[model samples]
Target chain A: MIRPGSTLGILGGGQLGRMMAMAAADLGLRTHIYAPERNSPAFDVAAEHTVAAYEDEAALVRFAKAVDVVTYEFENVPAATAAILGAHAPLAPNAHALAVSQDRLMEKTFVAELGIATAPFAAVAGETDLVGALERIGRPAVLKTRRFGYDGKGQVMIRPDTDPAEAFAAIGRAPAILEGFVPFEREVSVVAARTAAGAFAAYDLCANEHRHHILATTRIPAGVSRGTEEAAFEIARSIAEALDYVGVLAVELFLLTGEDGERLVVNEIAPRVHNSGHWTLGGAVTSQFEQHVRAICGWPLGATGRLGRVEMQNLIGDDAHAWEQVLAEPGAHLHLYGKAEARPGRKMGHVTRVYPESD
Target chain B: MIRPGSTLGILGGGQLGRMMAMAAADLGLRTHIYAPERNSPAFDVAAEHTVAAYEDEAALVRFAKAVDVVTYEFENVPAATAAILGAHAPLAPNAHALAVSQDRLMEKTFVAELGIATAPFAAVAGETDLVGALERIGRPAVLKTRRFGYDGKGQVMIRPDTDPAEAFAAIGRAPAILEGFVPFEREVSVVAARTAAGAFAAYDLCANEHRHHILATTRIPAGVSRGTEEAAFEIARSIAEALDYVGVLAVELFLLTGEDGERLVVNEIAPRVHNSGHWTLGGAVTSQFEQHVRAICGWPLGATGRLGRVEMQNLIGDDAHAWEQVLAEPGAHLHLYGKAEARPGRKMGHVTRVYPESD
Candidate 1:
């Protein structure tokens, strides 16, 4: 087992890695960040860092040898990189999780096979496959690349009158999955953690709002029925168990309210700490970042009790310019990512406001 | 004003600096730690660090230029060191605060001048002064070096038959102070913060216990009347205002529960985030470390509301070997400094228990 002073190797250097490093430090663990970027934000807070590319096998070997365990901030870790690091150190969430979550088709099939609800999705290997998928799944389906997609990138919404060929071309003819829209009443997610020993804990459901396909806000006590929230938690637990997961994972679900009453469909799964769980930093007894660290380190999990009713708003671009005003507001917790640029659609930081449930 | 990304230079590499750096990261501020010791605990978490002597003027200037503001984790920051850093960057709590806190004689005089009650003390420069002080203050008093003392170090108790010259020699014949010990019920501390703008917030009073003159544990709800707690806060506020202090300061007090009713006498002042305030990290709405960062950054103060009935225990020396057990216990928050050795009398870490007040 990794002790308090052991070093944890993290693969990635974005805000998620930075936050995770901070959490590890809180538990007396030292973190060494491995990324190709110079002056990566995570590097600032990490005890050590390696400036090398993911494909640099020698660097990866050195990094794995230096830490007790290895974990990554993103799911798109290259297969070769994961294998090289795993050969030298214990890798949390396992390589199987990376393979499944990296591909949309595999992730959907895995979810469907577990007796869980998911959007009707079909594989689209080529233009002919795209046509067949469109005819079978319906005209107004969403075509997404099977691998490496985020923030509405590598996907195109197909309208009833849209050309199938145009949609395929828009995604650069990559292997794709056609998902039939669910007409979700609200989008919710369950951020949870699972230890290697099969121990699991889940935070409260969070309803998310997006702007330009980027997450804008997350609110707890998601205006959903108790049953729906429980259902979301169950789906996340089942997925983690199936994957034999170790570390934090987020499962996004679509809550459809129609003639069938309220029901949930598994939209996607994130193998690492998700953006939607940011509120847990100040709103819960244990943050998802810390929970991930604990699970990966084979330590006992902490309480998931919420401190209060909480709402977290992402400070995209210019939104962070109001940090001074946010600091002035009582009961407001502000977190800045320390990114130098504030280009449009960039996530600069976030602010969380917590209110007593009674109020 | 030091903004979110601005760097805060901290002196000393003990647990206090480690915690202060973590809190600075919590608010998106970067920290640069400067300390003489190699492999200091604070180096693991700070954004930047300089391993150089406190007396190294060139290194101090470089460190100051690299950060937006300067603060210290220990009161014995040499006057010249503070002045060099102050000339390069703004130093919070000021040099005068350091001068007052570094010497027991000056601290007592300052407190008394502010209309605050303190133990009767006389400066002892040598054998004659010690003899005079012993004669005037009576037996069962304490002789302590005026500067560079902590955790019962550099002090000796005098009874009726003790030799004054021996007591003075025992403390290395250093300039010292003789305190007429107050007969008190218990020891308490008021951990508070002040901004340059005069904004102040104080955590609840904490009753403390000592083992072999080293602080062993601290409990909140100090077991004192409401008036006594308020008086402790008032004394702390007066000290801060008089010094024009900015950042967290701790005032150790002797709570006397006598026939005349409960009253408090200032014992010592800590011009930095103190050990007694560690409970506030998980037991209060806002932690003292974060409050100190906010104060020194010219930001608004956060709520000082207590979260529950809290008790904090220092994990000195081999006590930290139970970190695993502590982690297994539910709801017990454990923090360990990244020190390689577990020497006796060394503060390795701490654990805090926050029970619901009703429970």
Candidate 2:
């Protein structure tokens, strides 16, 4: 097991990696951030950094040999890269979890095999398969590329007037999944951590709202029935156990109210820390970042107890300019990602506000 | 005023400076740490670092020119070093605050001049002055060097059988102050912050317990009378106003009970974040580290509200080896400073537990 003062190698250099590095430092662990980007924000806070492309096998081998263990911030870690690192060091949330999470068809098939509820989906490799899948899944379906899709990218909404050929061409004729759309009452997610010994802990269910296909806000104690909340946790537990997952993972779900009251349909899974879990940083007894570090190090899971009624709001585009005003407001915890540019629709920072629970 | 994205220059490279760097990063500010020792812990978290002697004028000038503002983690910052940095960059808590805080005689006299209640003290520069001061202060007094003392260092107690000359010799016959020690029930402190605009916010009074003159545990809502708690805060506010202090400062106090109930006597002042305030990191609305960053940057101070009944325990020496066990504890929030050695009496980390306040 990796002990305190050991080095933790993190593979991706974004805000999530930056947060994980900070959490590792808090636990007395040194961090080495390896990223392709020259100005990755995580590099600023890490103890050491390597600026190299992911495909640099020589650098990757050296990085893996230098650290006690390896972890990544994003799910799209190429299978070849994971294979190379795994040969040199232990990679938590292991290569199996990475492969399953990276492909939409595989992820959905895995969930279905476990008897978990997911949106009806079918693989589409050609124009004929697209029409066949649509006929099987019905109208108002989402045609998404099997790999490298995020924040509504590499996906197209299929309507009654939409042509199947046009939709396939729009996505560059890539291998895709046609998912039958469900009119969800709300979007919610469960961010949980699992230890190698099979211990699992989940934070409270949180309701999420998106704007322009980007997550805008996340509120905990999601306004859902107790049964739905418990079911959400069970789904997360089963997924973690099946994947033999170590470290943090997020499962986004769609809350649907049908004749059976309230039910949930699995939307997708992020094999690393998710933006929706940022609220746990200051709103829970143990933050998701810290929990991830503990799990990946083969340490025990921490308490996922929520502190209060918490709401997290993302600062998108030029919204970060109001940081000064946000700081002036009482009880608002502001966190900025240190990105120099405020490009349109880009995430600059976030603010978390926690209020007392009603008596 | 140093804005978000501006660089913050920090003096000292201990745990306090490391935590301050983390907090500054949370607010989107870059940090440049300068310390005399190479491989200082703070260097791992800061964006930039300088390893040079504090007396190196050329290096100090270069450091000052590279950052927007400067702040120190310890009161022992040399007068010449402070002047050199102050000449180039704006220093928070200013040079005068540093000079007064570094010298015990000046700190006591400054507090007393403001009509505040501090332990009775007199400067003793020589044997003649020591004899006179000892006679006036009576027995059970402490004779300490006027500058550069901490963790019970550089002080000698003058008991009934103690020889005045011997006590003077124990401190190397340096300039000192004789203070009449108060027979108190408990040690308490007020950790607060102030802005350049004169705005102030104070956390709840915390009672402290020490083992071998090193802080062992700190509990908030110090079991003192409400009146005494308010008075302690008043003392801190008055001191901050007098010094025009623009950062987090801690005021240690002795709770004394006589025939007229209870009162407080200021023991000393820490011009930077205090060890006793470590509980704020996980137990308050805003942590002392974050508070210090906000103050020094000329930004608005965050909420100083306590979250619960909190207790913070220091992990000294080999106690840090239990980090894994601590991580397993359901509600314990463990924070380990990235120190390599677990030397006797060294502060390796701390664990904070916060329980809901009883109505």
Candidate 3:
């Protein structure tokens, strides 16, 4: 088992990686960030860093050999990169979890096979396949590229007046999946962790809101039934067990409220820490980032109890400029990612406010 | 004003500096740690580090010039070193605070002159002066070197039978002070912050217990009456205003319970973050380290509301070996400094447990 003094190698150097490195350091572990970008945010806080492309086998081998275990901040790690690192050192969540989550089609199919609910989806490899898939999925379906899609990018909407061929062409006719639209009541997520020893812990369900195709706010006590919350936990546990996951994973779901009752449909799976889980940093007894480090280190999963009724709002782009005002507010916790540019749609920082349950 | 992306240069690289660096990063500020030690713990989490003697003027100048503002983790920063850095950058808790805190005689005199309560003390420069101090302060007094004393070092307890000349010789006959010990009921401290704009905030007073003269545990609800608590804050504020202090400063005091009522007597003043403030990291709405960063950067001070009933224990030497057990305990927050060895009396880590007020 990895001990406290062991070094952890992280694959991505974004905010997620930055938080993971801080968590690792809190547990007395040194971190080595390996990312291709020169000003990767995680590099500033880590003990060691290697600026090299993910496909560079020599750098990957040396990085893996330097640290006791490896983990990643993003789910789209190339399968070959995972294999190379796994051969040299243990990789948390394993390569199979990455492969399943990297593709939209595989993730839906895997969830469906496990008796979980997901939107009706069909693979479309060619223009003809789009026609057949569109006929079954119906109008208002989304044609999304099977891989490398994030934040509403690489996807096109197919409404009644829109052409299926045009939507497919918009995504460059890449291997894609057409998913039937789910008009749900709310979007919620379960951020959980699992260890190789089969221990599982899940934080309270949190409802999410989106703006301009980016996460805007996340609030705890998702306002769902206790039964619905339990079901969410079960879905996350089953998915984690099926992948033999050994780190934190977030499963986003659409909570549909129909005339009969409430139902949850799996939206997507993030193999690593998710932006929606940022609330847990100070709102829960154990933060999701620290929980990920504990699981990957083969340590006990920390308590997932909520500290209070929590609301977290993302400071996207220029929103972070109001940090001085936020800092002046009493009891508001502000966190900023050390990015120089505040480009539109870029996540600059976040603010969290936790109130007593009664309030 | 120092912005979020600016670098904060810290003078010492111990655990206090390590925690401060992490807190600074949380606010989007990068950190540069300067310490003489080869393996200073803070170096692991900082963006930059300079390993050179504090007396090295060139290194000090370069370190100060590299960052927007400068702060230190320890109170014993040499006056010359502070002057050199102050010329290059803005130093929080300025050189005067360091000079007053570096020597016991000056600290006591400063506190006494501010109309605050302190033990009776006299300067002892030679053996003859030691005899005069002993006669004036009485037999059961403490002979402490004016400079460079920590964790029970550089001080000797004098009993009625102890020879005055022998006590003075034991301390190397350096510039010293003889203080008449106070028979106190308990030891408590006020951990507070002051911004350059003169904004002040103080956490709830906490009672402390020490083992072998090193802090062992600190508990909230010091059990002193409301009036006593307010008096403690007043004392801290007066000291900060007198020194024109910026950043976190801790005032240690003795609670003497007499037939009349509860009274507070000043013991010593720490110009930087103190061990008594570690509990605030997770037990309070805002941590002392983060408050220090905000204050020194010309930002508003954070709220100091207590989250709940909190208890903090230091893991000294082998106490850290039980880290696994501590991690397994739900809701126990463990923080380990990245130190390679656990030498006797060396602070290795700490654990904090916060309970709901109702509990």
Cα lDDT tens digits, model 1, A1-359, are 78988999999998999999988987889999999999788887889999999999999999999999999999999999999999999999799999999999999999999999999999999999989888888967899999999999999999999899999999999999999978888889999999989999999999999899999999998988888888889999999999999999999999899886799999999999999999998888888898999999999998888888999999999998998898888778888887877889998889888898877
lDDT of 3 by residue, B235-335 (tens): 99999999999999999999999999999999999999999999999999999999999999999999999989999999999999999999999999999
Chain B TM, every candidate: 0.99, 0.98, 0.99
Clashing pairs in model 3, backbone N/Cα/C closer than 3 A: none
Superposed Cα RMSD, model 1? 1.1
Top model number, lDDT: 3
In order, what is each prediction's RMSD in angstroms? 1.1, 1.1, 0.7
Indicate the worst ten consecutive residues by lDDT in candidate 2 chain A: A350-359
The number of the candidate with the highest TM-score is 3
Task: Arrange candidates by lDDT, descending.
Answer: 3, 2, 1
> Candidate 3 clash total?
0
TM-score for each model = 0.99, 0.99, 0.99
TM-score, predicted candidate 1 vs. hidden true structure: 0.99
DockQ, prediction 1 = 0.69
lDDT of 3 at B358: 76
Candidate 3 lDDT over residue span A47-143, tens digit each: 9999999999999999999999999999989999999999999999899999999999999999999999999999999999999998988988999
The model with the greatest DockQ is 3
Residues A1-359, model 2: lDDT tens digits: 89988999999988999889999998989999999998788888888999999999999999999999999999999999999999999999899999999999999999999999999999999999999999999999999999999999999999999999999999999999999998999999999999998989999999999999999999988989899999999999999999999999999999999897999999999999999999999999889999999999999888998888999999998999999999999999999988888899998899999988772
